[model samples]
Target chain A: SQQGEEDPQALSIQEGENATMNCSYKTSINNLQWYRQNSGRGLVHLILIRSNEREKHSGRLRVTLDTSKKSSSLLITASRAADTASYFCATPRGKLIFGQGTTLQVKP
Target chain B: EPEVTQTPSHQVTQMGQEVILRCVPISNHLYFYWYRQILGQKVEFLVSFYNNEISEKSEIFDDQFSVERPDGSNFTLKIRSTKLEDSAMYFCASSEDSPNGYTFGSGTRLTVV
Candidate 1:
C-alpha cells in the first residue's frame, strides 16, 4: 500500500514546545508530504520532502527524510495552540497513500 | 492562494439512493483526487483523475463509484447506491503534478441513512 505509519499516535504539549512526529513506510517513494487537518476539516499541506533530499523546512516546520531507513520525521518549533491537529504523511504513487496520522494537542 | 472548492458542504441521503459529490479543483492543476475519512478514522484514497480520465483507483472505488470532469474545472464523484458505510467526509484535492503539494477542499459530509 505504501502507506506511512506515524509514531506517537497522540501527543500533548504546552505551547512554545517543539513537537516531533515520525513516519515509516514499506516501499520506495517519489516524495513524502506532511499534511495537517483541523477537526472535521480538510487537510492542509505542510511540506514535501523528495526522496533525494535529506531535510527541508517551511516556516516553523522542519521535515527530514531518511531513504535508507525508509522513515521520515516532522518537527514543529515553538508550537502554538493553533497547532493542535492531526498530522499525516503521504507517499504519492499514482495516488497519495496517507498514514494513520498523529494527533497533536498544543495547550496554551 | 487558490483552493479546491466543494459544493453542498453536507448531504443526507437514504440508503440505496444515488449521491453525487461535486468539486471544483483549482484551475491549471492537472491531477485531481478524491479521499474520504470516517469519523475518527484515517483518511483513505478513493480515486485519481487526470486528462479527463481516471488514472488510478483504490479497491474501495467499486463499479458503483464513478468520477467525471464534465467541464474544464468541475470534478464529480457519483455513488450509484450508497450504503450506511458510505457516510463519511469526502475530500477533493488537486495537484499540479505527481510530486507537488495538493490543495484540498473543506469536504462534504455525506450521511447515508
Candidate 2:
C-alpha cells in the first residue's frame, strides 16, 4: 500500500494568498512530517504533527493531522514568491516514505 | 544551523560501473538515511542507518546497493554495478532521532550513460 499520497499535484497562487495542500496515508502512524524543496535543491524540514496532535504552527506555516481520518494538511498563509517549491508529506516506519509532492507556485 | 553535506553535486558514469556517493551528516545526529528522486518523480527511500548498521531499507535497495558509516562521520552509499535506471538525484539526510525532523543535503545528481 502507498504510505503517503498528497492531493492537488500542482497549485499556483498570487502573493498574499493562502495555499493549502493535503496528504493521506495508509496504515497507522506515530507522526507525520512536511517538507519543502526548492527546485533541484534538498528538502527543508517544515513541521511535524504527531498522531495525538491535531494542529501545529510555525511562523507562516500551519499543519494539521487527523489520525482517525488518516490524513494531514499544510497551510501556508500569505504566500510569497520564496514559498514557490514542492511540498511533500512523510511518514516514518523505520525508513521515512514521502508522498508525490504538491508543486506550489506563489507568484510575486 | 548544521547541515548534511553531500559531495560531487553531479556525476556522470558509464553503465555497469561502480559509483560511491558520500555524505557527511550533522555531527550530533544518530540516524542517517538515503533517498533518491528520479526526474519528475516522488522521492524514494533507499536505506536508513543507525547504530553503525542498516536499520531498514527499501525494495529499491537491491543486492547491488550497499551502505556504510566507515569513520563515524562519513556515511556512504555504493552501487556495486550501476545501471541506466540508477540515474537520479540522491539525497542524504540525518536526524537526532527517527521521530525528529531531518536535515537533508542538496543532493547529488547521478547520470548513468
Candidate 3:
C-alpha cells in the first residue's frame, strides 16, 4: 500500500495549545497535502507542501515536508475546539493515497 | 468558493443491486476522482477521470466499478452489483492541476445490506 502512516492516532489538547501531527510515506511523491474532516463530514483541504519545499504556512496551520525522511508534519497553532477533527495526509502519485488520519480533540 | 457537489448524501441498498453515485466537480477543473472509506478505514482511491476517460484506477476498482462523465458537468460512478463490503463513504474530488490540492465533496454514504 502506498498510503502514508500518521503518527499518534489520537491527540487531546486544551484550547490555546498547539497540536502537531506527523505523517510518513514509503515512496517518492510529487506533493503532500493535509485535510481535516469533522465527524461525518467530508474532507477540507488545509495545506499542500511540495517535495522540493521544506515548509509552508496557511493561516494558523503550518506544514513541513522532508523528502529525505519521506515524512511530513502539520501543526495547528493555538487550536480551538472547532479545530477538533480527523487530520489526514495524502500523497498524490497517480491518485491521492490518504493516511489512516490523526483524530484531534481540543477541549474548551 | 467553488466546491464539488455529490447527491444522495446517504443511500441504503441490498446486495447484488446496482447503485450509481453522482458528483458534479468544480467547473473549469479538468481532473476528477473517486475515493471510498469503509467505516473506520483510511480513504482509498477508486479511480481518476480526465478528458472524459479513466486515467488511473486502483485494484479495488475491478470490473464492477465504472466511472463516466456522461455530460459536461456530471461525473458518476456505477457499481454493477453492490456487495455487503461495498458499504462505505464515497467522496468525489477535482483538481485543476495534477498533484495539486483537490476540492472534495461532502461524500455519499452507501449502506449495502
Candidate 4:
C-alpha cells in the first residue's frame, strides 16, 4: 500500500523543547516527504529525504530516514508556539500517500 | 516563489448542488492533482491531470467528479452533486515531475449544508 503510518498521533511540549515524530511505511519507498498544516489552514512543504540519505536538515528541522526499518523521523528543535501544527509524512507511489498526522502543541 | 493557486477559500453549498473548484498551477509544472481531507481524516487522492487529460483517479472520483484544463492555464474540478459527506478541504497541487516537486495551494473548504 506504501501508506505511511505516523506514531504518537499527538504531542505536547514546552516552547524551548524539541518535538519528534515518527513514520513507518509498509513497503520500500524512494523518498519521504514531510508537510505541516496549521489549524484549518493549508499544508506547507517542510522537507524531503531520499531513501539513500540517512539524515538531512533544514533550519531547525531535521529529518532522518532508516530504510532498514522502513521508518523515518522528523525533529523540530527549540520549538515555538508558532510551531503548533499537524505534521504528516508522505510517500509517492504513482500517487502521494499520506499518514495520519501528528498534532503537535508547542506551548508558550 | 511560484505557487498553485486555488479560488474561493471557502464555499457553502446545499445538498445536490453542483460546484466547480478552480485552480491555477505553477506555470512550468506539467502534472496537476486534486486531493481532499475530511475533518480529522487522512488526505485522500481524487484525481491527477497531465497533458490536458486525466491520467489517474481514485474510486472516490466517480462519474460525478470531473476535471478539465479548458485553457492552458486554468484547471477545474466539477462535482455533479454535493452530498453531506462531500464536505472537506480540497487542495490543488502541481509538480514539475510526477510524485515529486509538488507545490500545494491554500485549499478550498467545501461545506455541504
lDDT of 4: 0.93
Top model by DockQ, which number? 3
Model 4 clash pairs?
A: none
Which candidate comes out best when scored by TM-score?
A: 4
* Candidate 2 colliding pairs: none
After the best TM-score superposition of candidate 3, give how far the Cα of residue B74 lies from its true spot, in angstroms: 0.1
B1-113: candidate 1 lDDT, tens digit per residue: 99999988999999999999999999989999999999988899999998888998989999999999998989999999999999999999998976587899999999999
Backbone clashes per model, in order? 0, 0, 0, 0
lDDT of 4 by residue, B64-99 (tens): 999999888889999999999999999999999987
Chain B TM-scores across candidates: 0.98, 0.98, 0.98, 0.98
**Candidate 3: stretches off by over 4 Å:** none
The clash tally of candidate 2 reads 0
lDDT of 2 by residue, A1-108 (tens): 688899899999999999999999998999999999999989898988889899999999999999889999999999999999999999988778899999999999
For model 2, residues B41-70, the per-residue Cα lDDT tens digits are: 999999999899898898999999999998
User: DockQ for the candidate 4 complex?
Assistant: 0.82
What lDDT does candidate 1 reach at residue B69? 96
| Candidate 3's DockQ | 0.88
The digit string of per-residue lDDT tens for model 3 on B3-102 reads 9999889999999999999999999999999999999989999999988889999899999999989899999999999999999999999999877969
- In angstroms and one decimal each, the interface RMSD of every candidate reads 0.9, 0.9, 0.6, 0.9
Error of 3 at B83 (Å): 0.8
How close to the true structure is residue B31 of candidate 4, measured as C-alpha lDDT? 94
